[model samples]
Target chain A: MSSKKIKAQMRVFQELENQLLIQADKLGVKDDYNPIKIKEMEYDALKNHLLSFYSERSNIEYEMQVLGTDKKEVLIKLEKLEIYIKRAERLLDMYKKYFGKVFKTQNEEKEKIEKFLTKSRISVSVGEN
Target chain B: MAYEAPTIAANLSQDKMFSAQKAAYQKLKEEVPKEKQNEGTQQMSSLVWETVEGKDGSKTYKVGMQDTVYLAAASSALAEDEVESLSKNNNLRFRDKTLQVLKNKMVKLAMDTFSHNFFVAELSKMGVGVITFQMGLLGISPAEIEKLMSKAREEKNIAVKNGLAQVASEKALFGIVTGAKIV
Candidate 1:
């Protein structure tokens, strides 16, 4: 990981450490026990919290590893999609060329005029019916 | 019939109260799991400590607060182990780890108490002679105090392997040489 990533990780750990210290403070000295004695219990709870917190962080790291692999797979899939898109674009260009050729044909204008006349006649027939 | 209804309600209430008490007692009696104990030991093993070899070939591991807290939790349940591997060696390891933790804690406490701004101002009022005399009485030199401050800042996790001479003497002055296990 980069230094920036490591620094971000350190900041997260520091935040967790601070939160744990707060929790430890809330576990004020047990009146029944002396300072050292209460501090001992507080220490145990803090340790457990720290252990579990680190455990969660490790789990997150594993997840990040898994996600990283997923990213590579996604990138490969994206490359494949881009290839498919390029092929489709080529097909579209071919269709456009074919349509352009057909439109430029000598009979093309007559064909469209005839079709329009036929459609108009059909509409007139329908009106009559 | 009326008496029977009231008796059943009373019995149910009593049962509920009894179970609540039992649960509270069980919570109090709960022991640290063997798995957690093993995990704690595994964690402690990973920490780097400056090992000091004693005169009698004993070893004391000096470590910072993080290691100390970890080892303290691990060693809390060290005594009741039925496992063969958790023998005298493990106990001694735990003891030494705890002692190192205590030593560091004492060092910090001494620094905070003696070197606070308010305390320094008050000490100055007494005169420079009193300040020198106090250091002499405490048997801790100004250099050692400065070293402790520097080490505390620079070291996140460190141990002075064979660094017992100064620590032992300081412990004597601090009068808290006992191990973590006793505390």
Candidate 2:
């Protein structure tokens, strides 16, 4: 490719990358009283943010290869992003597991109490009749 | 006239000479191991002497330590009187060649410094760009982002100032190396 064309393409890629980052900055979790719900929202936002980063990184890598430039700088940024993404993922997983267990236990307890109440009401109706 | 050895050396006692030599040897012993570890690397060693040929076909021995404290004793021994006499002498080709080598080294060093600072400044700017992208992913506050961006700008400004100073020095050194007459 001609140098001028490559330069122009690089400029477009940079602008697109900037837009993606701005979109990510604008991402916010909805206000919720439930901590689990808040975390879930955060996880979704983070997942989308990570997707943007991955796409942007791939685009940069492809362009760098085409332009015959060194990939060291891009690789460094990717490495740092990877570390943060992994930590975020770990936290998300922990919250999911903890909340999932709590909800399961609560549902089981609720079901047992409802069954006992139903049996008691049937016995009371029969006595009244 | 030949460059006469400075008479200051004659005043030094045997004990002082021995002590100086001992100290130099001790320093060499300490530093040689560090240099050995850097062996096979691209780093230049000050202990190594280089020979530069003059335009007049005279050879001069120069070492990187000429600007360092390792040569303090030798530089002190050169004495201002001997240096002035050498400069005034008709057959001072060696002294002129040495001066030329020093000037060349200074110009080269200034150029290197300028390029290094410029590169670092560019890298700092790039780092800020990357961090701006990361702030969104990491959910950093606007206030924090403002602080970080300002700090990055400050760092880049300092590096640019340093680079400009080096460029000015490089120009002056280049003029000296080329024997340009200063007004």
Candidate 3:
């Protein structure tokens, strides 16, 4: 993906990071806090944040090349850039699917436990609940 | 039942009250399936379930709010399988794909999200959801998460991916600015 897209993705990171930071500051030292207990968020998104920046800069440079600088040879490189963008997106998805389970909460685990325990009565409750 | 004097009743007419109750009853009645008219005895109740995983090397899967919600709303009958996603990171590695069955809802959500070929947008939405949860976990670095996010973003076309990324970023930023999290 272009740096623009990378920047876009980073903005999302920053947004979530910022919100957690705010919540940690908001709740004070005592709340029921089951769903969210430990406040373990890290900053320093700048490194990868810049990856997109570089990508965006490069794409604009590529766009400039296509619209003006070395139009003939750069076309192939441009094609490759587009391909990289597509590839990058695919990789993100695969990773997300593979890795998204990392963020499960206790509530979810508890629910799963509750559901399984309750299934013996599915036939009976199927009409009742 | 001539409820007329109380502030609650003054707020609504008896007809409105009965209509609302009737509507709810009507919906439930539909679920009951009238007197075995041969419409087929479909599922009418929920199976209550409580999942338990082996404490030793239970498979880990990365689940999101969307999946959590589905599982939360899931009847006890389905999703008996155990899955462990990242506590607040990007991947949910599992020793057995048997747990992949739990992801049926998530996969269904993805299919629904991309049902009309919105794969790119669908990927971005999942990314944002995952990233948000990761931020909640202590010690999570955005770079590491981005590395994963970038990889996940690869599933879509460039233009579409870029667009979704930009939009998600903007909304995320908006959430941050407004101090909204835990969705």
Chain B TM-score against the true chain B, each candidate: 0.21, 0.28, 0.23
Worst 10 residues of 1 chain A by lDDT: A21-30
Better of 1 and 2 by TM-score: 2
In the range A2-60, model 2's lDDT, one tens digit per residue, is 55655565465445433323222222111221345433444455455557657777776
TM-score of chain A of 3: 0.35
Top-lDDT candidate index: 2
Q: Model 2 reaches what TM-score against the true structure?
A: 0.28
As for model 1, its CA RMSD to the true structure in angstroms is 33.1
lDDT of 2 by residue, B1-183 (tens): 111111122323323444554566567668767866766674553332222222234333344322343233224234454444444443545434234333332222222222223453344333333333223222334355444434433443454434333433332232223322211
Interface RMSD of each: 29.0, 28.7, 16.7
Q: Which stretches of candidate 2 lie over 4 Å from their true place?
A: A1-32, A124-129, B1-183
lDDT of each: 0.38, 0.42, 0.38
Q: Model 1 residue B35 lDDT?
A: 38
Q: Pick the candidate with the highest TM-score.
A: 2
* B1-183: candidate 1 lDDT, tens digit per residue: 011111112345434544554464455346335435566455333443222333234444544323444464334322333212333343446444444333354344322322214454233323322222222222334455445434542331122211222322322222111111111
The positional error of residue B174 in candidate 3, measured at the CA in angstroms, is: 33
Q: Evaluate chain B of model 3: give its TM-score.
A: 0.23
